[model samples]
Target: MKFTDGYWLMRPGFTARYATEVADVRAEADRMTLYAPVKHVVSRGGTLNSPLLTVECWSPAEGVIGVRTTHHAGSVRRGPEFALPGAEQGAGVGKVRRDGEVVELVAGDLALRVDTAQPWKLEFTAGGQVLTSVGERGTGFVTDPAGRHHMLGQLGLGVGELVYGLGERFTPFIRNGQVVDIWQADGGTTSEQAYKNIPFHLTNRGYGVFVNHPGKVSYEVGSESVGQVQFSVEDQTLEYFVVYGPTPKEILRRYTALTGRPALPPAWALGLWLTTSFTTDYDEATVNRFVGGMADRGIPLSVFHFDCFWMRGYQWSDFCWDGETFPDPEGMLARLKEQGLKICLWINPYIAQKSALFEEGRQAGYLVRRPDGSVWQWDLWQPGMALVDFTNPAATAWYIDKLRQLLGQGVDCFKTDFGERIPTEVVWHDGSDPERMHNYYTHLYNRAVFELLEQERGEGEAMLFARSATAGGQQYPVHWGGDCESHFNAMAESLRGGLSLGLSGFGFWSHDIGGFEGTPTPAVFKRWVQFGLLSSHSRLHGSKSYRVPWDYGEEAVEVTREFTLLKHRLAPYLQRAAQQAHATGIPVMRAMVLEFPEDPAAATLDRQYLLGEDLLVAPVFTDDGTVEYYVPEGTWTNLLTGAQLTGPRWIREQHGFHTLPLLARPDSVIPLGADDQHPVSAWADGVELRVHAFADGAERTVEIPRSDGPGRTAAFHLRREGGVVRVTTDSPHAWQLRIGGPDGVLHSYPAGTSEAELRYES
Candidate 1:
């Protein structure tokens, strides 16, 4: 990805042609085209031998500008492309202005300015302030010694500007000096490879850039040019969109609007999930023991998952339960559902040779084939495994029919895994470019299954525990961090990945509770239990060993119970957060920098995150429970204990296994549900509007959405005047008013009483 040897020279075997001054400009109603020769044209003969790059600029939506630079206009188009649902709306109405030497296109508050008389430069501005610019030699077409072509573009980065979000990167939270490739791989948490590789990055300077390439996009963030983010693709053209937002949250909102907004997962999917870990020997009896164990310990569990090995060995994706392990699949699922537990089954898109459906897929031309017309088979995860041709609608229908059969037997959702291992030498059924389909195959694979689930279940009720994704993959509700080691370092790395993914337009993310590679130590297990239960979706999963808390220690069981109960109690607040994710693209678990973009202190802090808009969570990563976290400027109150701390500073504290730093921001009202046994309940039945450090004249209206269905919501209004806090609601159910301060106090009101007041000393 890096092209320069140093500041003054290019690396060997590389030749580059840069776009010079613009020769001519053609302005249209919705777009503008710039014709630039690679050399400055003082005479007509100067444009004869050199390449003339064609640059086209337009707006997809308000505040988003798309620029495409091409060397050749006759290249064949590819089949697989990102689905931009918002493009059809045509919200970006452009007004073009042609001054003496400058041509400008204004869309909403954002504008693109080009000076035809100067060297090729494209400057993006908002409110007359430059956000970023493409300067001299910024747009390039390069060729190596092998005669392969590449198109690249570089955007300027200001001093002290920080870059984040290239799709679930675990390397470092700040991607300033890293060489990142937007290629999907199955490498675990410790490697530079990522499962979800989105070629989008937002900076601290109030703008984001999304490379509209689905295949391989190589990025050098502040590394190639030392002052710009350079992205290149091995193609004849390069297209990217620059989105302007004065705030990080707004940037994500605009970005997701262009791609697709994340679907709202059901409320029950937000609760604690217990999974039969991968490679572990689990049968009906083992599942019963784990389910009964959690119930006996008073731990709230909402979903029970069965990982791989549910099918017979070497027969993955058969969609049939192994009769020996699960003799009666329907009966087992029915009994588990009777106990109020939803069911999830592990599945992937690959069909092994031993599977019963493999022959059907191969015979029907539903499997990817090599150039010689043979099925592309591999022996990596499973023996003689072939990928399902999702590009073929018949293949997708065949695959969905298998899963539909399982859904008929009472399976609620699926853990769609291993779409990252697609092969590039194979041919897609729809004649998509093979190199492009390597990363894009997951999108089709997940979309087919997700749409099927939406048809079977309702719209908001469909969810997937998907692992691999691309730019538009946020349409699926929930995604988890892939394989991680059972250790403190891996735990912190997982948080970094989640924060990065959240910034990349994903709304909900989760991880393995105690890691996936090894059996965690007691301290690791207990600490991870607290962290995982606080995530957007919590699941206890591992590889060789079971993730039952009792296997670690009795303290682990207690820690798991405490956090699971706390998550249920926090469901009202979390559900609203999830709704925000559905409406906008703001993630449920937000990075500290995303929430506090003005605070330089929060730019690189990835160990901690904001659980929602109100609560800040700093997961304990040490064995002794010692954690150091930064709190933005506020008088934050701990939601766990009645403790207050003034921040704009760092706080170091040692917590027990049962607690970590979960603080509510000042001047926030958190809706606390009364039920601790289940996430799906009447959230407004006996809720508590916990008011935290309201200002003298602060006013807030909180809407609590019901779990039963849409359109059933409870509204509560609160206003603080002098020393009195008055609360009023339009709900028929009883509720309480809790004021948070140094001494937390609670006051209750009857169901028929619609108004209440509490006097407190300021």
Candidate 2:
């Protein structure tokens, strides 16, 4: 990906060309086209010999500009395009000035300057201040030794600036000085993420550069030149979008509007999800005991997940329950459903030789094949496993039909796993380049299953416990970090990955509550239980061991019960955050930097996160329960103990079993549901609105969406104005309010309680 030898020389065997001068410019209603020659045409005869690069610029949505530069216009673009959001382009209103050896094109707040002479430079400015620059020989066309052509672009890096978010990277928190290839692979948490994305990074300087490509995008971030971020892909055309933020939140707002925000998952999906351990012994009795044991221990379980053992060994994704273990799956699910629990089973896109449908897929050309016309096989996860070619329409339908059968037999949702182990040596039915299909395959695989879920289940009810993802995978509801060791360090790494993924434009993310690998000790499991229940989606899964709380100890059971109920009680606030994630691109679980950009401590604190912009959750990673956390300049009150602390300083303290560093930001009105007996929906019926640290004149609105349907039907927003806090309702249903602070009891009305009074204790 990096072709530069150093700061001064280009690497051998590579030719770089850049637009030196804008020969002419044409402006339309919402677009601008520039004809720039790589070399200045001294005469009319010179223009005929050199290639004129065509750079077309336009706005996809407000505050986001797209630039498509083409060296050759007639290249064939294959399938596998990113499904970006549709937008209405606004009219342009800037001036274009051209002078000898210099040309400047200005549109609204964006300005681009092109140098006409040697070492061509394209500088982008906002309000007359240089933001980033494209330097000499920075943009060019590349053809690999295999005859694959590609367009490359490099932009100048600024001092002290950092890059973040290329989709679920497991590398360092900051993405600088790294050569990242955007390809989805089954490389675990230890490697540079194979599940890479083209969505570029938003810098600390308040601007983002996103590559508009679904195929493989290789990024050399400060690794090649140490002063430039170079990105390249296989094609003659390069398309990218420059989204202006001026703030990280604004950048995500503009970015998600261009790509699509995630859908808010169902209320039940937020509760604790318990799974029978993968590759462990689990039958009808084991499932019942796990469900019954949680109830016996007062741990409110919502969803029970069956791992790969649900199907016969070596025949995953057959959609048939293992008859030896689960004699009657339909009846078992019916009984579990009678106990008011949801069901999830493991599945993947791989078709094993032992699977019944392998022959069907092989005969129908639904399976991926190598160049020699033989079915590509791998024994990595499963023996003789072949990948389902999701690019083919009939192949997708065939796979969906099997899943539909499982749905009819009582499976609620599927944990779509292992799409990252895609083969790059095979050919897709749609003729997509194999290397490009590596990452793009996940998008198609998840899309097929997600679309099917939406069809079978209702709109808001569809959710996938997905593992792998690419660009635009945020449309799917929940994705969990793949596999991790059952240790405190892995717990922290999982958090780092989630925070990183959230920065990558993903909304809802989950992980194995007690880690996925070996069996966790009581201390680790208890600590992980608290952290897991607080996540957007909580699941207790592991390898070779049961994740049931009592398996560790009674204390672990107690911790699990406390946090699970606490999460159910906090559903009102979490769902609102989820709705915001659906509306904007902001993640439900956001990094501190996303919420507090001005706070230097927030930029480096991956161990802690601002949960839904209100609560700060620093999961205890050590057995000692000592936590070191930072709060932005404000008064933060602990949500559990009501202990208030002043921020802009680091606080280190040891916590108990019932407490962690969960603090609510100043002026935050955190809404809590009343009940934790069932899932979130039942609790949201009568919610208790808890107003925390209501700073005078600092208006804050808490919207609790209706649980039944869409469109934000039933909700309440509290606004503090002129020393009075007003709680207004959007739902016509009657509601009651509670005030807990220095104030005693607020006046409560019927379904629509628009006003309240708190007795201020001064």
Candidate 3:
């Protein structure tokens, strides 16, 4: 992807033609088009032999400029392009002025300028300051020795500028020294590869660059040359959009508006989930033992997942329970529901040859086929597995019908697994380019199952434990890090992957609590229990071994119990974050770089993350329970302990199995839930308000869903000045206030008054 040998030389055997100056300009009502030649046009003969490049500019949405540069306009337009929502049609024309040899097109606060004289340059400015510019020789049509042509664009990267979010990458948080290929792969969390590779990356400088292509895009982020971020695509034209935010969160709000935002997962999905481990012997009795053991130990398990073995071997995704092992699945599921647990069944897009649906799909042209018109089959994961052709409308309908039947039975949700091993040599039914369909297939696959879940359950109640996704796939509720070994290292890698995914525009993320590949040690399991219970969604799953808390040790069960109830008690605060993620595109789990952009220490910190906007969680990564974390400039109070700390600094401390560093941001009000037994609707009952680190002139507002009416809620406002505080609410229920401090809860209100005045010593 890198074509530069040094700062001044091009790679051998690769030819790059640069646009030297604009030869002709055509100004339209809504856009501007230009023709730039690759050399000086001193005479008509000079213009006749030079290569002319076509440059078109338009406004997609407010504060966004879409630019398309073409080398040749005669290339075939292909299918399977990325589905992008239109910004706004027919621009209102804010500013269009031609001064001397420069033409400026302004949309909102973003302006783009092009010089028509010699030394052609395109500069993008926001708020009258240059954000970035495509300088001389920056835009080129490149050709390599292999006879393949590419369109390349090199943008300016400022000093100390770091790029992030090329899509759930596990390499590093700062992408400055990395060469990234925006291609999806089956790589786990251990390598430089990624599962979901979105062709989008933004800088810490408050602007985002989204390559509008579904096919492969290669980005050289300050690696090929010294200070240029270069991107290339193998095509005749390269289209990209420059979006401005002036802030990291605002950048995501605008970017996700162009892509998509995540759906609000159901309230219960946030609680702990226990799964029947893959490749383990599990039946009705074994599953009962695991679920019963959770209840016996007072660990509230909300959703029970059945992994791959739920169906018979070599017959994966038959959408039917194995009759021999689960003869009374309907009755068993009903009984489990009676115990107040939801059910999740594992399903993938693959259909094995032994499955009855394989022939049904293969005959209806519902499977991806070979060039010879035969069904494409593979033997890696399952024997003779074939993929369902999601590009086909009838095949999508056929797949959804099976899920509808399962929903008719008692299945509450599904773990849609494995759309990553898609084949590029096969042919799609709808004539989509197979290579482009490789990553976009997961979007269709997840959307089909997610829509069925919404149909069976109500809107805002559907959820999926998915594994594969591309850009805009965040509309599905939840996704987990795939296939990791059970160890401290894998736990840390999963955290890095999840944090990267959160920055990549995913709202909710989860992972195997105790790892997924091998059996974890009791220490690792217990530590991961604390980390997993704190995630947006938590699930205990592994391969070749059960993930039951007691299986590790007695202490592991206690650790699971301690954190499960803690998360249940924190649901009110967590749900508010989820609602915000659904409204905006910000994530429930955020990287420190996104929240504390001003702090230099937070830019590269991956061991800790911010849960929503207020809580900072640092998962103890060491076996000795020692952790080091950084706090931005403020007085932060530990949510569990009343102890408080101040910094713009790092602190190291050792914790027991029951505690980790969960800090509340200064001047914040966190609503603590009442019931530990249920999470769906008990948030309002007996809710306790925890007020943390209030300073003079600090204001806080807390709200919790009311237990009584439809869409009803209760709210309270607290304003603090030194030792005196004011409280106000208009709810009929009684609530208690815990004035958090090092000493303890100084005062507790027995009954709620409309207005109260109180004084407490800090």
Candidate 4:
């Protein structure tokens, strides 16, 4: 996508034109139109050649500005636009101020300035400080060899400006010096390609730019020019939105308000999930053994996922249980559910020729077709597989009927997989352009199943362990990191992908605990156990192998049990965090930069992340069980070891299999459930409000939402003055209180108590 040869020359057979001056301007209520010819018209004789580039600017919602530049206004635009929230443009209202040859449109806290005189420029400012600007030669109309017409825009990159969130990238957490293409692909965890490529990026400078195109967007982040973040899109118009954060959290809030926030997944979906891994020989006996083994070890396994083998081989996505492997699926699912487990079966939007549904789909015109009106079939992962044409309503209904049968068999969730393998050289049912539908197919594919789940099971009960997503796919609940190798490097790569996805507005994300491509070593398995249990969603899945903890070693099972129980205890806090995400569009598992935007040290720290704003989880990525992590300015308390440490510094330590560095920030109140029997939907019987180190006037609120009804909620303050400490809460729920850091317990309050007001004086 790069056409510039070094800094000054253009590549052969390619030429781009830039506007040097705006010749005329027209102003409306909330929008401004500028007609800028490629060259300045010095006189009436000079206005004789080339097309005028039409650039229009406006504000959509508060703190957001949109700019659309076009070389040809007659170009046709197809369907399948992003599913943005219906907010009126300039909902917060804005004003136009004209001064000399400069016109400015100022929205709430954000202003877009345009110059009609010499050196045409477009600048975006927040609160009077310029964030980024489109300086000289920043806009170009490109003409390349293939006759492709593209509009490119370049924004100034300030010193130390690091960009993040082009969607689940595994290359590097800081997206500088990288050429990122916003196109969804089936590429795994090791490649520069991503499964979910959102065309939005947030910088450490408190601003974000979202390319308003569903098609592929080419981004050269400090790569092409080395001084600007340049983005280009094919066609006549380049439309983008500049959203002002003023802070990262507010940036996400406004962004998701424009797009959508994740629906709160069901409580059961938040707990530990054990899967019968892909290509593993699993029948009724094997599933029972794995499920029973976890129970025998007192491990709370919430969801049991049956991978691809659930359907007969070569007949992928038949939506029927393999008769040979699972003869009695109904009775089998009932028995597993009797053991307090939810069922999730893997399904994709493909119908193999060998499948029983293939003939039906092909005959009913429910599959994608070629130009010759023949079903577009491929033999990549499945033999002669044809994609389900979700663009057709009847085809979607036919697919839904097949899934409804699985729900009848007690499948509580669906692992909507393989939407990334969608082909672009085909004809869609609704006549949607194949190129545009390539990435947006996942949204439709998952939406069909997610809506069906909501129809069957009531609202707030639908959950999907989806693998592929694009922009606005956050409306679906949970997505996991796709295939990864079984190693420390792959573990870190998965975390980077999840953190990047979180920055892209996804609320819940997970990954395979012990990796997905192969079996993990015992040390790696146990370490990933702690890390997985800390994610927003936890699951044990892999390819060509089983992910049971016992398969690694007894130590793996012990570590799994310990962390699973700890996660179960942390469910109250986790669920509240999820609710906050649903409300505010912030992620449950956030990157440190999201919580600590002021700390430049946190902008690149991908190995460690903050789990729900209070606890810092640094997963050990070495065989020696040592980790190096950064803590922002604070008096932090280690949650696992009860040791208090002062930071704004880096700490490196080695540990054993049972422990990782789990720390709690100062002045935080962490809630723990009393029992680990049922990790989902169970009310806290004897809740323990673990209060960490605090200063006077520091208060914390804990809100626990229940499935059956409104759950118990509490807020308390911690104050230490004149050699005395006091704690207070207005909660009516019965709970105990514990005071201390990780080093040792200060005191434990009696159970069945609602409030504990104690004074400590020396």
Q: Estimate TM-scores for all models.
A: 0.99, 0.93, 0.97, 0.97
The order by descending TM-score is 1, 4, 3, 2
lDDT score for candidate 2 against the true structure: 0.80
Q: How many steric clashes between backbone atoms does each model show?
A: 0, 6, 0, 5
The top-ranked prediction according to TM-score is: 1
RMSD each, Å = 1.1, 2.8, 1.8, 1.8
Report how far residue 676 has shifted in candidate 4, in Å: 2.0
Q: Model 3 — TM-score against the truth?
A: 0.97
Q: Which stretches of candidate 4 lie over 4 Å from their true place?
A: 86-92, 681-684, 706-712, 717-725, 742-755, 760-762
Model 1 RMSD, rounded to 1 decimal: 1.1
Residue range 1-762, candidate 2, lDDT tens digits: 866567676667665666776677675555668787888777988788777888887766655667788988986777677777644334453355667666566655666666655455678888778888887556677655455676888888899888888887777888889888887777666677645354567777778888988767889898887888889988888999777777888888877777778877887898889999897788899999999999888888889999999889988667788899999899999999998899998999988899988898999999999999999998887788899988899999999999999899888898998887677788889999776677778888888998898999989888999998887889887999888889998888888888888887888989898888899989899899888888999999998888998889888888899898899888878887888898887998998889988877778778999789888999998888898888789788888877788879999989987899898788777777767766556434566766776766666656676656565545567766655667666656555554433243544466555555554221
State the C-alpha lDDT per candidate.
0.92, 0.80, 0.85, 0.86
lDDT of 1 by residue, 193-261 (tens): 999999999999999999999999999998888899999999999999999898999999999999999
Candidate 2 residue-pair clash tally: 6
Task: Tell me the lDDT of model 1 at 363.
Answer: 96
Candidate number with greatest lDDT: 1
Who is ahead in TM-score, 2 or 4? 4
Which residue pairs of candidate 1 clash?
Answer: none
Encode model 4's per-residue lDDT on 1-762: one tens digit a residue.
787999989899888899778889998877888888888788987788777888888887878888889988887777678877835444536677899988998878999988676677898998779999997778768899988888999999999898999899999999999999988888999999998989999999989988888878999999989989999988788988888998988889988888888888987776789999998899999999999999898888999999999889999988888888899999999999998899999999999999989999998999999999999998998999999999999999999999998899899999999898677789888888788888899999999999999999988899899988888899987899999999999999999999999999899999998999988899999999999999999999989888998889888888988898898888888998988888899999899999999888888999999999899999999999888999888788888878777889999899898988888888787888876666764444467767777666566666655444644455555565544556565544556656665434445654335455655321
Q: What's the lDDT of the predicted structure labeled candidate 1?
A: 0.92
